[model samples]
Target chain A: MSTSSTPPAPPPSNRISGTAISKEIRAELAVECSSIKSTVTPGLAVILVGSRPDSLAYVRMKKKACAEVGIDSFGYDYPETVTQQELIDKVNELNADPKVHGILVQLPLPNHIVENLVTSAVHPDKDVDGLHPLNCAKLVTAQTHGGSVKMNWKDLKSIPFHIACTPQGCIELLDRSGVEIEGKRAVVIGRSNLVGMPVSLLLNHRNATITIVHSRTIDAQSVVRTADIVIAAVGRAKMVKSDWLKEGAVVIDVGINSVDAPDTKKGYRLVGDVDFDECEGKCEKITPVPGGVGPMTIAMLLRNTVNSAKRVCGI
Target chain B: MSTSSTPPAPPPSNRISGTAISKEIRAELAVECSSIKSTVTPGLAVILVGSRPDSLAYVRMKKKACAEVGIDSFGYDYPETVTQQELIDKVNELNADPKVHGILVQLPLPNHIVENLVTSAVHPDKDVDGLHPLNCAKLVTAQTHGGSVKMNWKDLKSIPFHIACTPQGCIELLDRSGVEIEGKRAVVIGRSNLVGMPVSLLLNHRNATITIVHSRTIDAQSVVRTADIVIAAVGRAKMVKSDWLKEGAVVIDVGINSVDAPDTKKGYRLVGDVDFDECEGKCEKITPVPGGVGPMTIAMLLRNTVNSAKRVCGI
Candidate 1:
C-alpha cells in the first residue's frame, strides 16, 4: 500500500451543461462537413401549403441555418386553397427530381390534402424528416431492405435520416449535458409517434431503460417523479408541474407553446412545455424556450437533409 | 316536482368470467369456420429444430388442434444439430411454397440458430404469430403489409390471422365470465412486444383505458395493485404476489414457469407467474398456466392458419 493507492469515492456533483454538449456535437458536425467535399452543397426543399406566419418564421430560420452549413434551400409558398391532390403531385415531382434530395411539407397543411398522402409519397430513402410510415418502421426495427430479405449487419447505417427533430434534439441535449443514457431510468410524458415514440426507441437502442406514459397511464405523474431523466413533450402547457420532477434531474422540454401573454410588447411570450419558473432550482439543467429545442430542431433538419443527400450519392 | 323515472347506474359487479369468455370465443370461431367452406384448410408449415420433450408435446398438441379445426398441417422435424443457414434456407423454401399458407418455427431453437432470425424470415402475410418486423411496423404505425410492398387490403383475409391468442384469450375468458373490457382501468405488467405491446394496442383500440408497465417502470407492483384488470406476462416465477393485486381484479397470468416441486410425482411441477395460492380469495377471475393461455395459443394459431389459406385462395 503506497501513495499510489486508489483515491476515495468523491462526492456527487450537480450540474447540467447541455448547451456545451450540444455545441461540441455541432462543432464536430461542422468539422465533419468541412472534411468532406467542401463544394457539395446539400439541397433541402420546403413546401408551405398556407400563409401561417409561424410556419414561415420557422422555415426562414431553417433556410438561414442551411446557409450557415453550406446547404442550399428552396421553398414553395403555396396558397391555402391548394388541393390535396395538387400538393401530393408536387411532392411526387420533387421526389423524382435528382437535384432535390429532401422534401418537407410544412405541417398544419390546408386540411384539404391528407398529411398521410404527402408523408407517404416522399421516397423513404429521401425522407429526411423520418415521418414516413416506412421510415418509422425502419427506425424501430433493424431489418434490411426491400432488395434483401435478410438483415445485413452493415445495413443499419443506411437507416433514413430525420427522425422526430425535437426528440433528436433531446438526445443531443442529454449527451451534451453529460447525462448518462445507458441503463438509466427515462420516462417520456407523451406517446405521439412523432417525438415520444421515436425518442423512446432511440433511447432504448442506447440501452437506457425507458417508460412511456400516456393519458391512460393512471398516476403517470408519480412515475415521472422517479425518472433520472424526464422529457416533457405532452404538448400540454406546463403539464409536468415542479413537484413531479426528480431532484437534479436533467430536463429536456421539447414543447414550444405560446400561452396568452398580454404583458409583453409582442402580446405573447414563448414558453417551453416545462414550467421554467418552478424548475430553475430543482432541475440540474433545462433549455430555455425560443433558443433551446427550437434551434436544435432546425439544425437537425439541415443535418438530416445533408445526410440524406450523402446516402443517395453514396458519398 | 316532476316524479320522472331515473335510470339506475349499473352496479360494479364481479362479472368478468374468464373461463366462460374463452369458451364463448371458441364457440364463435367454430360457427364462423363452419359457415365458410369446410374444405378451406389453412396450411401451416411447422418447423421443429429440436427435440425438447415439452416442445415436442406442444407440437403434437398443435397438430391435433389443426386437425380438430380442419386445418392442413405439415410438420418439418429438423435434428437438434440443424445449422442456422439450413434453417434460413428451409424458411425461404416454405415462404415460396404455394401450399403453405402459414409458417411457424417452434421457439427455443438449439444453440446454433438465432431465434429472432428464423422467426423474422416468415413472410409477414404468412406470419401467423405476428412476429415479423413488417407486422411489428404495421402494429406500431397502424399500417398493413404482408411483405415489402403495399399489401392490398384484400390480402388481409389471407394474411396470417390476427391471433391475439393470449390477449384474445383474456378477452375470451372475460366474456365467458361476463367481464366488461370497455371503459375499464387496465394495467399490463411486462412490455414484451409479443404479448404486452400487442395486447395494449388491442385494448386501446377497444376503448379500454390501459397502462403498460415494464422492468424499467417504477413501483410496478404498486401500479398493479390499483388496476381493475391486471395482465401478468413477465416471465418471472411468483413475481406478482397476491398482495399487490387489487381486490377482485381480473388477473390473466400469461407466464409459464417451471419451479421445483419434488413433492409431486414428476419431480417438478408447473406454475404460473402468479402465486395462485395467495390469489385464491382475491382475484375475481384467474387463468391457470396449463389450461389458460396455452390452449388458447394453439386455438388462435389454427384460426390464423385457416384465415391465411382463405386469403391466399381469395375465398
Candidate 2:
C-alpha cells in the first residue's frame, strides 16, 4: 500500500486523522469570521515563566495553531529571576485587557511564586485553559455552582475547556476510527482534572459506563482490559500493554512520553503511554502520538478562545 | 456466628458496620471528650422544608445523635409552602447568627426552590457538614493550585454533611478496625461525593490506589473483588456478594438497604450493600449494618459541628 493512499490505518487500531476534524472546525470558524467583518479576534495571553525547552515548544505550537485558526496570540515571556508579585501583575494586566480572552501560565512555575494565586488572577472568562480554581470547582462539584465570572460569559461557566479539550480529542479520535463509545465500558487510567476526570465526564455523558483508575487504584489493568474504550494518561511509558487490553478495545493513549528511542535520529522518539506495536492488532482503534491528540489539543484551544470571546462579547 | 450478634439490616443494601470498631471509636472519642469540656458544645441547627417522611426520619436521627454527643440541637421545621426567596432569607439569617455553628437543610427540597442556592448560602467555616461549593473547591482543587492544605474534608460539596459524615466514619472505621489504608487497592463501588468520592480522596491522601466503579462500569464485581479494602456505597441489596470480595479484603459497606425479608415484621430486612452472610469468615474485619457506618456518620456530624464552631468562633 502506497503511503499516499493507504486508507489511513483502518485495518488495525485505526487512528482517525485529527487534521480532518480540525480542518472542518477551522472552516466553520472562518465562515463565522467572514460573516462579521468587525470581528473581535479572541486574544490569548500565554505566560511562560521558565525556559524549559519542552514548555517553550508546547507554547510555540499553541501560538502557531492560534495563528492558523485566526486567534491572536499575546506572549508574556518572563525570566526565572522575576518575583511572584511581578508575575501576578502580568496576569492582572492580561485579566483586565478587554481583548484578551484567554490566559495560561505554563506548568512548573518558579518555586517562590504561588502558581494557583497567579492562575486565579486571570478572570474565569479568560481562563481558556480552564485551570482556574473556579473552573475546577464547577468540574468536580457541579457546573451550576461555578464561581461568578467577572464578565457576562454565562456559557464559559459550563464549558470546562482545558480538561474538556483533551477528553474531546480522545473522543474525536475514537469516533472517527468507527469505535463505539455509547453504552460501552470505558476505563480512564488517571484521574487528574486535565485528562482523566474530564474524559470520564465526557464518556459518561456519551453513555459509556466509565471507571476512573488512578495511582491510588487497585487492579487498574484488569479494569482497563474490561473496557470497550481504554484511555491511559498516566505518563508512565508502556504501562498499558496488549495483555492488559480486551481484544478490539479502542485505546486512546493520551500520554506523550519520550522514552529512550535512541534508534531514531532525534536521539529520542515520541511514544505514547501504550505499547503501540503490541496494541495495533489487539485493539480496533488507537490514537498515535505527535500526530494524534497533540495536534487536536492546540486546535481545541483555539476553538475555545474564539468561543470564550463570543460568549463574553455577547456576539 | 449468632443472629443476636448480627443486627437487622436496613434501607437498599446492608450498610456494613464495625460493631467492634464503633465501640472502639466511641471509647476513643469518649477519651478525647473526657479532656474537653462538655459546656463548650457544638451547636447544630437542623432546618427542614416540607414533611417528607424520609427527610423527617433523617432529621430526627441527626437530632438524636447531637443529643448523644452533648451538642445543642436547634430544630426549625418549616412548611413546604415556603418560597425560595423566603428560604434564602432564612438561610442568610442562619448564616449571620453566631448562635448557629452548623446548619443542615434536609435534602430533596420541594423541586420548586433551587437546591444549590440553599446549600451555598451556608458559610464555609460554619459549614461543618462541608457541602458548600467554596468548601468543595477547597477539597477538589485547592486555591493557589499546589498549596496542599488540600483537605477533602467530611463530604462532597453537595450534601457536605453527607460526605463529611461518611468520610469521618470510614476514617474512624479503618483506624479502629486496624486496616492499613496506605498503598492498598481501595475500590470504592460508588461515584457519589457523599461517601464514595470523598472516601476516594481520603484514601488517595492516605496513599492508596483508588478505582471508582459504578453501574456503567463494565464489570463492577471483578473490580470490587480486587480491592485490599472495598467500600460499597451503591445502595443495591446484596450487590456485593462474598465471592465478589477477595479472601482477606477489609469491607466497609455504606449502603443501608431494605430488602424483602418474608420472615421479618416489616416484610423486609435491612442490609448493607454487602451480603453479611457471605462476609462472615471471609473479610479479616468488616462492619455490620445498623450499628456500623450509620452510627459513625451521626457521631462524626456531632464532631464536625463542634470543629466548625471552634473555627467559626475562633475558640
Candidate 3:
C-alpha cells in the first residue's frame, strides 16, 4: 500500500493555570497588606456554623491564605444548634468592630438558620463575601450604565462595592489569562445567584454580549456552541461535553463535583461541569478542575478584604 | 392571460395593545384601591425636582392616574436650584409619614442634585419607583433560586418588594398577551439601569433563556435574530429593523423616542426603537410605542402603590 501524507496534529490547548496566577496575585496582595499595616491591619472575620468537613477544610485553607498574605484572620465557630438571632447579633458586633474590615459567613449553614436574613444582617461595608443584598444590587446596577464606565480590575480599591468571590475569580481568570472579553459572545450555563448570575453581570460589565442558558433552556448545546467564551457553572459532573463547545472558544469551568473513581485513593475524583479530557483540545483556552477557579476565589477574597481595609482606613 | 397559481398571504401579526392592557389593570387597581380604603387609603408622594416640560407632563399624568384609582396623590414640586440635602430631607420626611404608602421620585432630577442619595433616602417600603438599592437587590436576589420561585405577575401583593415599573410593564405585556416566555430565546437590546438590565433579569426569572446585546456588542443583528422574543429598549429611534428579528418573534418595544416628522402639526412624532412600519408584519407580536410600555409604566406604579398599602395596612 502506498503511504499517504498525514495532516498535522492540532495545536495543544492553552491550559490556564489558576494556581500560578493566584500565587502571583497573593504575592502582590502580601506587599499591599504590608504597606497598609502601617495604618491599620486588614482583618477578616469568618463565621462558620455546623462544621462540615468540607467547610472546615475550606476555612482552614482561607485562614492559611490570610496568614500568608499578612492579613489577620478571626475565626468564629458555632454549633449546629445556634439560633439565628445569635448569628445576627454576632454579625452586628463584627459590623461595629473597627478591627474587622471584612466579614464572611460560610455557606450551607444549618437548616434551622434562615440564610438570607443572616447574610443580610452583615453591614454592606464589611461584606467581603459580597452576598449581601446591597452588594449584589451594586453588582447589578454598576454595569447598567451603557458601557460608560470601564472597570480596572487591578485597582480593587477603586470599586465602591465588593463582588462575590467566585464570580470575581472567574473574571480574574479571564483578565489575567489575557482573554478578550469585550464584544465576545459569552454563554453562561447555569443561573445560580452565587456564581452564574453574578458572573454574567460581571462579564456584561466588561462589554461581552452575554447569553445566560439554564435548566429551562431548550437545546442548551446549540446555544453553548455559538459562544466565543463559555462559562460552565452548572455544578453537574461532566455535564458539558466536547460537542457543546465552539472550537477555539475560551472556557472557565466554575463547577467542582465529586465523581466515582474507584481507582483513586478515596474512591472518587473531583471533576468540573465540563468534560476536561474531551474538551481540552477543542478549546483555545480552558481552566482545569481544582487548579482553576478554586484558587482564584480565595485570592479575590483576600483582595476584597485588603480593599475594604484601605477604604476604612482612608488610605 | 394564462392562469397562474400563487401562494396565499401570510397571517397578520398580533399587535399587543398595551394601552388596552393598562386600562384593564387600572380598573383592577381601582377595585383594589377601594377595598384597601376600608383599612387605609393608598397615598403616593410624587417628587418632581424641576419644571422640565416632560417631567411636568409625567407628574401630572401620574397624579391623574392616582386620583382615578382612588389613591391620594401628594405632589412635591422643587425648583431647579434645589439642594441635594433639601431633596433628601424632603424624602426623609415623606418616608416617616404614615399617610404615604409609596414615594416616587421622577427621574432625570436637576443636575445639581445627587440622585442616588435622594432616592436611597426614601425608605425601601415606600420606594414605589424601585430604584432604591434595597429594592433593586431584592429584584436580583428574588430570581437567583435556579427557577424555583415562579413570579405570578397578577399577584402583585405577594412579591414582598417593589420592581421597577417599566421593566415590570414589559413582563406584563408578555404575560397579558399570552406570549409564552419559558424555555424561549429572548434578546434584550440595551443595558440601561431602568429598562434593559432589569427586564433581562425579569425574563430570566420567568425561565426564558436571555441574551443582552448593547452598543459594544459585535454582530448584534445576528445575535438578536436567534431570539424567539426581542426586547428593544435602546433609546435610538427606529434602530431595530425587520431583518434583525427571527420569524414569528414576539417583540416588546420599551423605547419611546421623539423623531422629526415634518407633516405633523408639532413637527415631531413619537416612535419606538423598532421600525414600526417595517417590523409590524414581520413580527408574531409587537408593542406600539406611545400606547405600549409608556402606559404600562404608569399602571405598574399604581399597582406598586396599592401593594405597598396592602402590606402596610396588613390587609
The candidate scoring highest on TM-score is 3
User: What are the lDDT figures for the candidates, one per model?
Assistant: 0.70, 0.71, 0.89
Per-residue alpha-carbon lDDT of candidate 3 for residues B1-315, written as tens digits (9 for 90 to 100):
957677768765488999999999999999987876779999999999778899999999999999999999999998888898888888889989999999999988876666777788889889998888778877776832222255564544478889899999989889889899989999999998889999999898888999999999999999999999999999999999999988899999998899999999999999999998999888889999878889999999999999998888787
DockQ of each: 0.14, 0.34, 0.50
Scoring only the A-chain of each prediction against the true A-chain gives TM-scores of 0.85, 0.86, 0.93
- Among incorrect, acceptable, medium and high, the docking class of model 1 is incorrect
True contacts kept of each: 0.12, 0.43, 0.68
Model 2 residue A255 lDDT score: 90
Q: Which of the two candidates, 1 or 2, achieves a greater lDDT against the reference?
A: 2
Q: Which ranges in model 3 have alpha carbons more than 4 Å from their true place?
A: A1-13, A143-157, B1-13, B143-157
DockQ of 2: 0.34
**Model 2, A117-146: lDDT tens per residue?**
787777877787766665655555544543
* Candidate 2 Cα deviation (angstroms), residue B241: 3.9
Higher-DockQ candidate of 1 and 3: 3
TM-score, each model? 0.75, 0.81, 0.94
